[model samples]
Target: MKKVKRTTIYDIAEKLGITASSVSRALNNSNQVNEKTKELIIKTADELNYKRNTLASNLRKGQSKTIGVVIPRINQNFFSNVIAGIEEVTYQKGYSLIICQSDEDHDKEIQCVNTLINQHVDCIVISVSADGNDYQHLQNVLDHGIQLIQVDRVAEELETLKVINDNVQASYEAVSHLIEGGYKRIALLEGPQNLSIFKQRKEGYLKAFKAYNVPVIEELIVENAWTKELGAEGTRKLLSLPHPPDAIFASTSDFSALGVLDVANAMGIKVPSQLGICGYANESFSEITSPSITTIDQFSVYMGNTVANLFFQEIGNNDTITKPKIISIKPELIIRGSTKRNG
Candidate 1:
């Protein structure tokens, strides 16, 4: 048996008794070609399984019809949902996606950006890693004449299309919810300060304290306690203090809140009775935890769809709408058992 060679325009043109140039022009919807010829060419091309070499066609057209997406971790629930949303839109627009994960490493993130650039992707969407501070990699994407879109964990310095949640407002609302539930002396577990998301959350926590006329205690604020282990470590320290906090806000993520729950449970401290807990990024597990953790829903899937649409709007429309755009999605606070006082 002979191996089948990939179908080409020449094959289709030959079958239709036409020149290859005619087939090419028709396939490209050139004004020089008649509409009937274009329809016949497309129909025959489809029947012959003549898959146009997207790379070569894109090169000729000067548009790849492909987009690159970079995230901290692909396995994370939030990032995964965002990717799904991006794919939903890009697929509809006949575009392809190349996804890369940075694993929270700045060097790896830089390499991922370079790889995407090398691939000549039309657009590069990114959610910066925790270790990211130097944004030369993100800047390089823009310098390469590629559309740069930052979503979720974005860098503030770069003027690009940014689709993000209202982190400060969401955090403030969550903290306020706890306060309304009679939680005072609320301790906070913060993420890495380098990322704007964490910094905004920290600011919200501080603002909530100031609004309530509660003195901000430096001792209760733990730095870089974004991980489960770090959250546990921070909880141990906070709970050990002679004036231990009555509540804890894991402003990092749900994983950190899980850590707080475990530590409190291990120490025989009843949730909502002794301590109230709140988390960010409403993970699925947050709802299932013994005392379901109250959290902020960032609408990860909706955020992703918004990011994809931003790119589609820019690339699909052949215009010079060059103004840098910023879109902030408001997040909702989900109340659960962990933060509720009355049974």
Candidate 2:
């Protein structure tokens, strides 16, 4: 199939028998151009279906007036809400967004970042992929003088603007709640330790155990159980142990916790009484489950808004040298039936 050429000011100029500069001036509503010529140029532009090159225009002014956002997945509730929040602010500020999803692949994430960079976007906001161990692409954004903002999952070594949840504290609260609820022999389904967020969450879980004087059982912790399928697999193994845990914490996400619940129900294990469950990231389905899962509300939408606001605030500053800023939002632990044994 042949590509259709986009109509430009030059095409309008050629059709109207006028200079391209005059056509450009008229299209931009310049006062120098007479009303008659402007009217004619606009009419011709409409006929030709001419669209203004906003990116080129903004680039001439040393900006693109556009932001690029990269996420692991587009369908996740938390990510979609965050995108909505970002769009809300960016639209109001007359800025557009170019969204890309890495599908949790490290290579795809790098490609997305490079594409955004080549587009000459003014800012790049990213929640790094799970499998990404190298961050040269992120550093390249900074090298190219593009404003970079890391949200949710991030590489801690880079001194860039970041908006994140207090994962450690949130995890601590979740685990502490389980301990207080008389659920001993608790198990943890943890995500990949390569990411700082997951590492922080593990730290919090350990802290809670220390606070309560609960002996940490190394055998009860499952690694890389961040997804629903992995969570279910881990749950099966845990339940099959000689001394199965009475409670399980899916520290990765609500989806993982849902997996735990599914496995428990299948085995006829009663929630809260025989097996308690807790999850991170208060996904919408968490509240609607038969036995509503106890989870942490990350305030994902608010986090997105905060990231945009931070970009605007930092860009407005005229300082030659700026220190990296980190904003941590405290997540709320919502207690539900999944862990409410006494209730």
Q: Which candidate achieves the best TM-score against the true structure?
A: 2
In each prediction, how many residue pairs overlap at the backbone (N, C-alpha, C within less than 3 A)?
0, 0
Candidate 2, residue 74: CA error in Å? Answer: 1.2
- CA lDDT of every candidate: 0.91, 0.95
Please provide, for model 2 over 1-343, each residue's C-alpha lDDT reduced to its tens digit, 9 standing for 90 to 100: 9999999888888898889999988877999999998999999999999888999989988999999999999988999989998988999999999999999999999999999999999999999999868999999999999999999999999999999999999999999999989998999999999999999999999999999999999999999999999999999999999999999999999999999999999999999899999998889999999799999999999998999999899889999898999999999999999999888
What is the C-alpha lDDT profile of model 1 across 270-340, one tens digit per residue?
99889999999988889899899999999999998999899878866776766788999999999999988
- Give the Å error, residue 303, model 1: 1.0
Predict model 2's lDDT versus the native: 0.95
Candidate 2 stretches greater than 4 Å from native: 1-5
Each prediction's TM-score versus the true structure: 0.88, 0.96
